[model samples]
Target: MTDDDPDRDIRCQDALQAAYRELVSAAIMAGWSEREVVLAIGELADKHLLSLETNDNADALIALLRRMT
Candidate 1:
């Protein structure tokens, strides 16, 4: 990963909650239900090793998850 990559420093910042919120918002806007959005977010977060205490590599993860549906 390059230093300029936005997700590069997410692991160093406590941005997981914000990232999760954004993911949920996007999913809802994309017509997914609350349960579907939550499941998708959780799966994506776990797949990417994201946690509340971790900097979130959420940008790419969110993008990838969105394509699943």
Candidate 2:
């Protein structure tokens, strides 16, 4: 198990960046325009901010999204 090391946050940020790169590559391959991806990511950020403001479970946000679809 990884301890609460000093560099933990940096490591996590690096991992997230790698994952984001992979996802963006796949999305481009799937014909998503850069603008669309940016807009969608902004929308996701907005939803997460709303969740934080309401002190709600992020899973509830996912459920709400499923309902919208």
Candidate 3:
């Protein structure tokens, strides 16, 4: 962890960054334009944010997203 990270969450940040990078890389590899990738990610973020204040399990979100396809 860097000294600037007072909360010592560098590892978590690293993992999240890796996930984002992989998602973008995969999207581009699969022929999704940059705009399409951003739109898809925005859709996912919207769905995720919608459940943030609900009494819902994260696994249920996974199932819901899977069903979306």
Top-scoring candidate (TM-score): 2
Worst 10 residues of 3 by lDDT: 51-60
Colliding residue pairs in candidate 2: none
By TM-score, rank the candidates, best first: 2, 3, 1
Using TM-score as the yardstick, the better of models 1 and 2 is 2
The whole-model lDDT of each prediction reads 0.76, 0.83, 0.84
For all predicted structures, in order, the TM-scores are 0.41, 0.56, 0.53
Give the per-residue lDDT digits (tens) of candidate 1, residues 20-58: 678789889999998998887678868677564354566
For residues 1-69, what per-residue lDDT tens digits would candidate 2 score against the true structure?
277788988888787997887877788889999778878877998999997877667668988999999
TM-score of 2: 0.56
Whole-structure CA lDDT of model 3: 0.84
Alpha-carbon error at 58 in model 2, in Å? Answer: 14
Q: Clashing pairs in model 3?
A: none
Q: For residues 31-66, write the lDDT of model 3, one tens digit per residue.
A: 999889989998998888887745367778888999
Two-way lDDT contest, 2 vs 3, winner: 3
Judge candidate 1 at residue 57 and give its lDDT.
62
Stretches > 4 Å off in candidate 3: 1-14, 56-69
